[model samples]
Target: MKVKTLEKLAKDMIDYIINLSGFEHIEDIQLNVVDNLESGDMAECNYNDSHGYIQLNIASNMINDIEQAKYVISHELGHILTREFHTYYVNFVGLDDDDMTSICSNVYEQTAEILAKRLGRLILKLYEQKDK
Candidate 1:
C-alpha cells in the first residue's frame, strides 16, 4: 500500500480505538512510518504523560499490509491502555537488579501482547458491525 494511505488508515484506527477505549483525554497522537527503528522493533509507542500525547512509530519496511498495520498499531494502543497496570505492578513490587524484576517486566510485555491481539480483533469486529 502507499505511504499516505497507510498513514491515514493508521490514524483512523487510532482515533477509533481511542474514542471507544475511553482515552479521550489524550490530546495528541502522532504517527510516524519510518524506514527502520533503531531498536529493530516493528513498532514502538512513546507516551508523554505530562503532555497527554503519544508518538507511535511503525517501521515501514516491517509491515506488509493493512492487517499487519492494524495489529501493529493496536499493539501500541494496548501498551497505552495497560500503562497504569504496568506502573502499579512495578511500584507495588519494586524494581531492582533482580530476577524477579526481570520477570515482572516480561509479564508486563506479555500482557500487552495478549491484549493487543485480542483488542485488534475486537476493534475490527466492532468497526465492521458499526458500518453495517
Candidate 2:
C-alpha cells in the first residue's frame, strides 16, 4: 500500500484500539511509517509494562492488496490490544500479497486476532456510517 493509505489505516486502527481499551487518560497512541522493516509485513507493535507504539512499514511489498492489508492492520492491532510480544508481530501482520490466514504463534495471539477482527469490524462500520 502507499504510505499515505497505510498512514490513514494506522491512524484509524490506533484510534480504534485506544477507544476499545477504554483507558480514558491514555488515549495518545502512535503510529510510525517506515520505508523498510525487518519483517516484510505491514505492521508491528512493541508493548511493555510502561509504554509502546505501533509501527507500520510501507515498504512491505506484500501489502499491495487490500484484504491482506486489512488482516495486517487487525493483526497489529491484536498486538497492541492483546499485549502480545513484539516477537511474532511480524508474522501476524503477514505480507501484503500473502495468505489471509493468520500466522499466530500461540493461543493468545489467536485470541487477540479474533478479538481484533471483531472490534475492527465494528470500528470500520462506524467509520462507514459517519462517511454517509
Candidate 3:
C-alpha cells in the first residue's frame, strides 16, 4: 500500500484503540513512520512516562504489507493497553525495585503479543465487514 493509504489506516487503527476501555483515559498512540529502524525490527512501541504518550513506529519496509502493518500497530496498541493495566498491577504486587524491570518487560511483552494478534484479527474483521 502507499504511504498515504497506510497513514490513513494507521490513524483509523489508533482511533479504534483509543476508544477501548482502558485505553480511553490515556493518550492515543502516535504513528511515526521512518525509513528504517535502528534495531532492524519492523516496529515497536515507545511509551513516554513523563508525557504520558505512546509512540508507535512502523518501519518503512513493512508499511507496504497491510497485514504486517496492522499487526505491528495492533501489537503496539497491546503494549500500550498492557502498560496502562500494569501500572495498577504494580501497585498491588509490591514488587521489589530490582524485580520490576524483568517482570514488567517479560510479562507485558508476552501478554501484549497474544492480545495484539487476537485484537488485530478482530480489527481486521471489522474492517472487512465495513468494506463489504
Each prediction's RMSD over C-alphas, in Å, is: 3.0, 7.7, 3.8
lDDT of 1 by residue, 23-119 (tens): 7565667788777889799888775555656688888777788887776776677776666664566568654435645877677667767876776
Residue-level lDDT of model 2, residues 1-132, one tens digit each, is 677777776677667556766744334345666666777655665443334444434444557766666666765555555444443454454333244444444554556667767756765555445437
Can you tell me which runs of candidate 2 are displaced by over 4 Å?
A: 12-28, 52-60, 65-71, 78-105
Which portions of model 1 show Cα errors greater than 4 Å?
49-52, 94-101
Candidate 2, residue 1: Cα displacement in angstroms equals: 2.6
Q: lDDT-based ranking, best first? A: 1, 3, 2
Clashing pairs in 3: none
User: 1-132, model 3: which lDDT tens digit per residue?
Assistant: 466766777788777656644465544567777777888887787766555677777777656687777766766666666665545544665435456467665675467578777766776565546546
Clashes of each: 0, 3, 0
Q: Where is model 3 more than 4 Å wrong at Cα?
A: 20-22, 25-27, 86-104
Which one wins by lDDT: 1 or 2?
Answer: 1
